[model samples]
Target: MPREISLCDIKGLVGSELGVSAWFTVDQSMVDSFADATNDHQFIHVDPERAAAETSYGGTIAHGFLTLSLLSAMNFDCLPRVREQQMGINYGFEKVRFMTPVKTGSRVRGRFTMAEARFRGPSMVMTTYAVTVEIENERKPALTARWMTLIQFDPKDRPSET
Candidate 1:
């Protein structure tokens, strides 16, 4: 688990590794739910029998976006709260690649490293994470993303808001 960190702590370690999230499993239920939400009922993602017979993956697999969505929960698990900041926004992503299939029943976790952090006046623009979602027992990663976040804070407290 990552230690609880304030905005100040992040500033001090601007170009350093920050944290990693605990492992989370991708099961059939999750896949089914994602399929329902996205209306992507591709056999490889939702139909186990057809996938087993037709696809190289051997069974139902998770949708790529489903795997990407894991970032939200994963980040929450890994990143400590910025007490002084009112909120943080999902600024954008620099790069995102899905390297391998995430088969149903496999476990995945994210490892985050801070790439860069810059103060944009009252707000901090942080290109902070190179998140790799690794599959348990698999050689390749399920997804890799360079994610950015904007942390907004009060200027009056800048000195104390590291």
Candidate 2:
């Protein structure tokens, strides 16, 4: 479950470590499903036998985007929720770097650090997080990204004297 925090508490959290998410396994079935969904049926990602013979990964690997897409679930599992937030939008990433291929059957999880938080207007706040998706037993992370999200809430919910 995500920790709950008030809107007024967001700015205070800037530059702090948010939390690490529960580990998620990236298996062959999941890679195949993602390949089918995105029409990205490249051999390296869908064919374990061929991948082992042809690639340095030694087995099928998950797509970088597939790994990136896990951020939402990872965030939900670890990041704090604003008590007054009615909705949140994936405002997109400032940067993303896929540093390592996540091999099939590997476990991965997200490590998040709050980089910045600022009110966008009376009803919205924008936050930036420095995220790294770490692979179990691996020295290098699967990916690193600077993610941004826009949180929406009623202006009336804003703490008074703002």
The most accurate candidate by TM-score is 2
What is the per-residue lDDT of model 2 for residues 132-158, given as tens digits with 9 covering 90 to 100? Answer: 999999999999999999999999987
For model 1, residues 1-162, the per-residue Cα lDDT tens digits are 346666666656655666778899999999999999999998898889999999888899899999999999998888777776777899888999999999999999988888777777765646468889999999999999999988787776555444
Q: Model 1, poorest ten-residue lDDT window?
A: 153-162
Error of 1 at 137 (Å): 0.8
Model 2 TM-score is 0.96
Off by over 4 Å in 1: 160-162
Looking at model 1, the pairs that clash are 7-162, 8-162
lDDT of each: 0.83, 0.93
